[model samples]
Target: MAPSTTLYPRATLKKIVKAHSNRPLTKNVDILVFLNYTLFLQELMKEASIKSKQSGERGISARSVRRVREHCLRKFKG
Candidate 1:
């Protein structure tokens, strides 16, 4: 299998977390940690759905994407 490429670099993620630190609420902090990943996945699903539509295939599901997003948020919550 090929190596996985990182969508967000460590420094970028650190910056996001740092920026959100100003708020310091539990919900905001949780969003700060998982925002990048959630956004990435959402974009990925959007693209995949578009491509699938072009190819006349079934597209990605919004419900499934939400479930995945919630799972990540829960996993990253401290």
Candidate 2:
């Protein structure tokens, strides 16, 4: 088990995994998947916010998110 930051509920995460997977996930795999998802979202949003600022936007917009999305994914792939 991970230290429970609990950004999202465990049951919700498990449901998502179940919906996609052919086999059941282990408890640790569930936590790891959820953690990675949250981290990716966090990084994506952070990059989008910065992109918005650079373009003189007041806040993150869909366009800003779209622009920075590939860059954020590349960071994760490394």
Q: Pick the candidate with the highest TM-score.
A: 2
Tens-digit lDDT string for candidate 1 (10-57): 566566766867754443444455676677666657665665566566
Where is model 2 poorest over a 10-residue stretch in terms of lDDT?
A: 1-10
Candidate achieving the largest lDDT: 2
lDDT of 2 by residue, 23-75 (tens): 87787777788668789999999989999999999999999999999988887
lDDT per model vs. reference: 0.59, 0.86
Clashes of each: 0, 0
**Model 2 lDDT at residue 23:** 87
- Per-candidate TM-scores read 0.37, 0.65
